[model samples]
Target: MTDPPKAWDAELVGKWLERRLAAARHDQAAADRRGYEARDDYDKAAAEEWVCRALQSPDCTREQAALARRIKELIGQDDYRATGIYDDIRFERHVRGHLRKLAKMTKANEGFEKTLRYQ
Candidate 1:
């Protein structure tokens, strides 16, 4: 019988998640600076779509999936109008919050190996 694929280590998944989140945030920031505003419903939809794609990608681990889900939810909640001046700021805040959570997860997983050694 064929063996099942091994589950990824939480620490490894956390690192991968961190990298993906950073890349996404950087891309969004660059786009924002270029006047590619995300204040409209269409833009929000596109952002949510991108998050959904990331979540469904084969490269996404469990940790990344969870983070992506939160990002998608944030995008859904964004009510910024095209006339608003704080659209970019609000979006950045959401991204930063999620990034912080990703960092925390990475730190928490750092000692995972020690605990598993006893198991």
Candidate 2:
């Protein structure tokens, strides 16, 4: 049997990667202008802010911010070998669990905010 045709051509893939790299570089430059010492610092700060918003909370607690940073770190490592997971599937599942936890926390925080508003 003949092998199937490839879904993506090399040129197309290269162009896609180039666009992504360019966007990443632009973001890095903006972060530098904003006084972030490193790209990771900028990413962590953004993640912390996202986490706080997802939780519907006014501010991120130290632990919540840490969790957000951890999530970012885990995300950059695409495989189990780097993240200590047994397999890729497990790694994705782990990340999904963390996301679910964030959602739940957000719901609880929203309720708390509502309670405060009512009182």
Candidate 3:
């Protein structure tokens, strides 16, 4: 016979998820700031060199090469802000959606556990 399912504390799970979300947000913000600062200090020759290096790398993805080309274009136009980077908002939304799904699963499991205990 199969063993019974384990019980989980919904409150504890919620708290853990919240902490993870906060950490992810903080990390994303730090990365965005770093990227912006790096772009500010970047030059056309540096961008071109990076693109050349990327093109030479066998492991570089098409998306990465495309991004490198875009960076070179931005450098030529003197438009650092148009780098088309920073997916923090999208990442946060995905994390929140995943957390919500986990919360729902936890709630369902808690209800099942309560039913099992009472029986």
Which digits, one per residue and each the tens of the lDDT, describe model 1 over residues 1-119? 98764444745554454455455545555556667454433333334324334444443445534544554554455553333334565544544454445445544444223322111
Query: Which digits, one per residue and each the tens of the lDDT, describe model 3 over residues 66-106?
Result: 43343344334422221333343433343344334433544
Show where candidate 2 strays beyond 4 Å.
1-6, 37-119
lDDT of 2: 0.39
For model 1 the TM-score comes to 0.33
In order, the Cα lDDT scores of the candidates are: 0.44, 0.39, 0.36
Extract clashing residue pairs from model 2.
Answer: none
lDDT of 2 by residue, 52-102 (tens): 333332232323344345445544555433222223454354445545554
User: Predictions ranked by TM-score, top down?
Assistant: 1, 3, 2
In candidate 1, where is summed lDDT lowest over 10 consecutive residues? 110-119
Estimate the lDDT of model 1: 0.44
**Cα RMSD (Å) between model 2 and the true structure?**
19.1
Best model per TM-score: 1
TM-score against truth, every candidate:
0.33, 0.28, 0.32
Displacement of residue 33 (Cα, Å) in model 3 is 2.6
